[model samples]
Target chain A: MGSLDTRRLIVCRHGERCDFCFSTHRFHWLDKAIDEAGRYQPFNLNLPRNLPKRRGGYDSFRHDTPLTEMGYLQAKLIGRAFRDREIKPHHVFVSPSLRCIQTAIGILKGMNENHTKLHIEPGLFEWMRFCRNVAPSWLTVDECLAAGYPVYQDYIPVVKETELNMNESLIDFYDRSHLVSKTLLSRYPTGNLLFVAHGATLDTCTRQLCGEAPRSNEEFFEIVQKTPYLSSIEARQTGAEQFEIIGTPVPPLAHSANAAYDSQYLTTPGYANNTDTL
Target chain B: MGSLDTRRLIVCRHGERCDFCFSTHRFHWLDKAIDEAGRYQPFNLNLPRNLPKRRGGYDSFRHDTPLTEMGYLQAKLIGRAFRDREIKPHHVFVSPSLRCIQTAIGILKGMNENHTKLHIEPGLFEWMRFCRNVAPSWLTVDECLAAGYPVYQDYIPVVKETELNMNESLIDFYDRSHLVSKTLLSRYPTGNLLFVAHGATLDTCTRQLCGEAPRSNEEFFEIVQKTPYLSSIEARQTGAEQFEIIGTPVPPLAHSANAAYDSQYLTTPGYANNTDTL
Candidate 1:
């Protein structure tokens, strides 16, 4: 019990997404997607209105989505919030994606620690579905390091075709999330750990912690209202085998300027201002 | 059945080990190690006699055990045999270990195809147990390319300490091996596949094909007599859900010169003869 209180987890969703993802907003099929019985099940193909079209015969940019400028600022605000509260984490973890990297970098800046060893966990990468597994020419570890991000020296992403499991489903992702949870417990044991990843990771990882997620539709929306834009949840290990979400999830609505902020719209400060040279 | 016959799996274990693994011969407990029931059960702590003593307080040599000269030669011989028999694999899969790399390289040389793109699959790495998880200085992917081996341009190893599941047991190893098998089937569903890895991989992967591994003491020895040295097994996917072990597992005794070979000893032609420099 004493040790459980010492170990805490800050499960966070990466800030707003690339223009590619945002332009294809939810009004097209989001309500329909939720209304369908498929939402209760896993891996049901819920095609949205604005699915990014393949750029060409072999367009890598069709995927490998990056965080928009607004997303960066949201991450920055979260990092600043931690700094403002004097919350010093023993380690910071992020997924191996451009968006997560930018968000982690922004958060790092907010924490005022440029050299914090940021671990790029491939397991935390956004769930692959509907052929979303095909990645673009990803930024290399050296590029991350050169770009002033302190990605761990040994960081490596899954690259080989054989390493990419094709039959991966939502269940598989959930299993991986369970694996990640076990890994966290075994490695950190006792420390303030920060995780910057995806919405699925948040749901799955938190489920592994407290054994359940926001089950009710209203509850799910309530917990995820600010996610993928600017949301964070705190899970405190209450026992060796138990965890309790301590702090409230600070979703985007609370951090953003006003209610006028379009909930469905992906607000960005524009790409020109954000130099994403890769 | 026709497709199954064409789509076969040739699972081969890496050959031999460096002086570090060899000098610590079984007078410390190799022979007796297998004799115990703990062997049948799994997770038996059988520390080798000469378990490479650290050269100093920090010695990376303790774990990144490379292959010896004989091991390389054995791999070359297997490659030559495959080439002689005209058994050309469309793709070559190998673990990202120095020994596996050396073996794969030696095999590539023997096959006379120096440019075959090798996929470094971390899923195929030697099983880890105890503190053996703490890796030694691993050879980088760039080093492989510099050494003239054609590694995939986008090969990346697994990262993140928490992503490394510490409580992994033999069951976990089997699960991973099963994942590797599934990956092999789904990725190249209709091609001849080759896996170059360790004995445990051979054991678990074969189990995925047919059914179980050898359980009896003698049967276990028979199945693994020459594994991790120079041995090969052929598995043909019989049905969508069935497989047949076609060719025999070519154990070392059948390949090595005479009965004079010491099977228990990690055979080497001396490090002076085998280059270890990356």
Candidate 2:
């Protein structure tokens, strides 16, 4: 058995999502891509090349969007960096969101670790306040398996999706995340644990595990807003049932956004005509 | 010889640039990443994994920066899309900018076209107004070759770097690009040609060939601003020397900007302490 001191936990945010980045007040790719005849066509390169079949149909993407191309790439790069640095996670747990599942897949592909399967933990999902007091219609374990994701077929989650407190306060959210973290850590008891979820998971899941107090709503929002996609935090086991928050194992990924190119600009008349050259 | 109807020309903008995306007025990665000892270390994932050596040393990145991680991926994806669609470019020409050269390399890699080499052309560069009346210290063809780029070392440029009109107006920019376009198409009249350069190259190089007038500064700027990274335009030969500007063969790439994550928020106090859960 590995020493308890070596046991570590990593919490990471999912990569860029299509809805938050591409959708406007009046239009969204999810709505525009699907034809009345049920044909799906992606209009932009940053959008997902394909989407997995969902129980709620394509409309479910409004609540649970997939990662953009760069989003997947960001997660994959982080995985490659971890592989190069020899930081291996023995067990992987991810939020039930499609973006989170895709991110976990990208990381595993990057690390070239085909053997490790992901545990789809609804307990690891983002704050319910952001979800508007309702559980996101996430894909089931069977659905995820059919989608070719390396999900553990038999691993049961500590906190089921239906049991999530959609009306939970900030304090309740912290307790729930802390409970999940503790349950998973205690259950495994050895090797490293990696969590691929939302921005707040980096804090909520490990904050109480490190014996830190829960943050207020304003504080929690501030942390979530500051956390960019694929940002991660690491925690090391310091004592019995205790962990200390360590710095990230890799440098945080950063890049400016790419704007959608408008074809109209090619012929849009602005001001004046061709002038003579010097 | 291929039919005149089958001959094609594609003009493309380079991928996301490191300097334009990551640098602020106060601090630039080129200066910050290099220590006083001249050891180069990338502080972020979006910055180039490694930089090619230059005659002006690491400081040269100020004028010629490499592509961000997503930038390279965007170009590669476009290449893959083109390859999938069987849109093969028999010859490729690239601007002297590091980003443009790197983009060409990415596209070639994606298309699995190892036999083709890039012809670095200074004439295809963006407007001199943006260059501030001075030539950017670009990597020599030999320097690029030494850096493992597949460059056509023996191909003499139609317009040398020193010949670029640093003080030229928008009309001059269009005319220069037009001359280069006409010269290249006339010289190699059989196969398709692909030019990877700046956002404006999609217009400046092909507009005149299509019998369109030079765009005014206002008009040119509008087009340039709307042209996202890896944006492309195609032109096909019509009669003898005449060509018609066709629309893009692939979907325009798009995504939102990624903000840099600050670690301070993790520990920074916001408001109040942990309250009892509901």
Candidate 3:
């Protein structure tokens, strides 16, 4: 058990995504999965078996995509790590992006905290510039609930979707994230909290809380690139409005990807090219 | 679903393993997870939540470690891939190793073939040299069933545990695998058969069926090292006694591992290292 005054927050990025990992300039999952008949055929193993319906059709996944199978496993591993380390969070907040929401689900399932519903905060979404100055149509709370996600239906979001500024600068994005972090801390007062959001959430939310100015646009981009999928950071509140970033409780998970095996290579030099005796 | 003469076999290696991935000469998971108190405490995220009881004790895991979480996911993904491609396996055979058995479980769950029980074959086990010229004590079918694995109760393996030759040469190992493959194909003459086993199983079992001699020991070792986890190969019987290796139904799954993030890196250099206002 933590002390009554202890306040800690851990922020994590979403897992591997299909669009970012598999999409090419000419080809995207939206084009491959949904055919002329409008039927979804999963041609790839990484693609999700079921995609949740959004108001703006499935093409909306161009900006907002679901996590790959490995991505979900990565998130679940972190959640299990948290459970192994006994880093219990009293409140869990998430970005409304499908990837983050799916990551939160994997994490909670890993932690065996199935009952803890995720508080989807629109303020936790990534920078507007990444979304091409347009907010992606995220799945609504009702849509998420209908899709069997464990969403906190009664709780209101810190930032409404309509309030999101598509033209917000990098500094403005940082300020928004800081405000949401601060507001959540104030509301919770004295318990561990978890945030499942984008790569920049680690810096955007915690930098100002630790009394540091936001990084320049160039530096922020560098930081985002360095943040790997399922990477996490921890911050502990020590005094009034003061928090210190600390080492994560778990070690980073690592594994090499398996390449496709071509059976042609398995052929011996002297063997009959065609083995069948017809 | 096919002509009565159709006979297809798919050979797959087990998923990622904890021992191979995490174990070192100085540090092994067996020592860390099990304490002097004889109680198991999973210190790492990749460690299994519960280990099945074996006569050789937990140390038995030194030779037969369970699959990592990623391993399970890999197997399940392959299963899902089979489902996606509509490649149904009428029968499944697994190596007696714990990793292979666990992988079989994940694959079956992914294929949604919960009713399909696994046939544990000692003959399907890896080369004796790899096990250091000693047959390791494996989890008995009863023990596996008690642990809730879907093992076929009535089926008897072609090779018994006591029949394993610890001093078998490389050629002998190939012959053993070939015998097992031949026996299985003869038993199930028409339906699609799946073998969930070791790396060399792909070559060992199918080499003779395809009318090829086994590779030299050096070549064999190289092949094993090159064979990645969850890699699979497919072979179809074209004649009464002839089989031809062909392309797998599903593409290989790929993803880079995420590196762990340290919170110390997030601190701005100019800011106070200590944020607390004391």
Candidate 4:
């Protein structure tokens, strides 16, 4: 007890996805403009807008599109925020999804080379999706935006259609998360740690850390936003078990008026200023 | 850039080492004592402690020891710290040294399971005498530690020894370090990045970032200490070159504190609180 310092842990969600495609999008306007221009756009041959219902209703879950450029930028912002906070972690564990991997890489770019070692753990991936899952006709992007929770009944059927799909239940994800966390906690007990995961997984972890399930979409958002770009949680040893809570989230930028600020549209100051004009 | 939020990057140092052997000490004193008392110590022969030396009787470099039990504990502490922080990086780059690898693994145990991809870049490895083509030496530990930094007068001779034993020089190391950093920055300009590097290599990057060489051991210590456990640096873009120095020397733990917290002599907090028993 005397040898180890008090420990801290923080869990955060990856940034937003395209409302329509669910892929990571980089340039909202470029995509919008491309869609409007309509002529000579890539994928026009395969995905014509005026196609009949059967063909036009392509199953998005079957596709593995890379994060949109904007999504990559969001990840970069997360990375930059971590850098600004001076949070040097001993290890970085991330989910294997392309978006998560990209996010992890962007964050690493913003950090010093001395402290971080990255590992890709399959167990930390998003809850598995069963095959041939489909979104119900009643599901709407607006509903999702307003509710901030996956309308599983509407989304599950559409997802089940994908090849190699594996659905991970909340219980399954929770169990896996607990196992992974426990293994790590038992092994390293104290140091800077980072985990890049999906929103659902983050939500599950949030519930575990907070001792209550998140009650609303806004609450989830608050939890994710409040989750530090880099933060800590104290781990206490009680009898045979160790207990810890996800600590407060730390934003990378300062809370001052001059500090970088952004909401949905504005990019963070550090990233915005340093962006390459490609 | 207008569409994305700012990102953060955090970088931190790995943990302690064995004072006597320079190996990573895995078992804290308490663990060791318990193992010894239980007669469950691993079967490891006490090999001879011969140090490498140059022609002029000055010690040559050597960096191939494994982590001692205490070193393992230090790595574990670092892992816990990372877990507490909830930092999830995208890419993890590591130097291929025994100590660093062990440290990386220990830290990974504390992080998310999704970070499974571990890349071993030879360039990220420590500056080694063996790598420079130097011949083997037969000296004692005291002789090696007492040997001052390589002198200019001994350059040719050392180079020749390096040729024979594959030992690397400071200049060779510097070039390698630069290449590693440059390559990564170019490849993942806007990604989260994490690197597990050697002490000398980390020092070199810090020096480059701060635009000054470490003038003294004290100065070096201060620089490293001030480094955030996890922090980001903006990628500098000079025409085709895209990288920035967002952070500086992420230090190892304090020397004095480390000295007082000797792994061999003290008990680990998790196992027991009795220093005497250890």
Residues A21-74 of candidate 4 have per-residue lDDT tens digits of: 221246432243244444323221011112112222323213322343334434
Model 3 chain A worst lDDT window (10 residues): A269-278
State the DockQ of every prediction: 0.01, 0.45, 0.34, 0.01
TM-score of each: 0.38, 0.93, 0.82, 0.31
lDDT (tens digit, per residue) of candidate 1 on A56-83 = 3112323555564445545666676678
Best by lDDT: 2
lDDT of predicted model 3: 0.82
lDDT of each: 0.54, 0.84, 0.82, 0.39
Q: Single out the weakest 10-residue window by summed lDDT for candidate 1 chain A.
A: A257-266
Over B1-278, each residue of candidate 1 has an lDDT whose tens digit, in order, gives 22765667777767656433333343321333334442311011112112222232113434555564445545776676678567777777887766677778778787897668888777777555633657434555676666566788685433322344655666676667777777767767777778888765666676655765423334333334324354566777777867766653231211111011111111112212322211
Candidate 4 reaches a DockQ of 0.01
- Tell me candidate 4's interface RMSD: 20.3
Model 2 ranges off by over 4 Å: A271-278, B271-278
Q: Proportion of native contacts found in each model?
A: 0.00, 0.67, 0.49, 0.00
Encode model 2's per-residue lDDT on A1-278: one tens digit a residue: 33788888998999988888778777887888788888778877778778898788888888898998889999998998889788899999999999999999999998999888999998998888898755689888888888898898888898988888778888988999999999999899888999999999999998999888998777777777778898888899988877887777788787776766555456556422322100
Best by TM-score: 2
Name the lDDT of candidate 1: 0.54
User: Candidate 1 chain B — worst ten consecutive residues by lDDT sum?
Assistant: B256-265
User: lDDT per residue, candidate 3, B122-146, as tens digits?
Assistant: 9999998888755678898789888
Q: What is the lDDT of residue A126 in candidate 3?
A: 92
Interface RMSD to the true structure, each candidate = 31.8, 6.6, 7.2, 20.3
lDDT of 3 at A3: 53
Write model 3 residue lDDT over A1-278, tens digit each, in one string. Answer: 33544678899999988887666677786787798988776656667777888787777777789998889988889998899788898899999999999999999988999789899999999988888856578888899998999998887778878888889999999999999999998887767989999999988988898789999877777677667788788888878867887756576665545554545547644332333210
Q: What is the model-wide C-alpha lDDT for candidate 4? A: 0.39
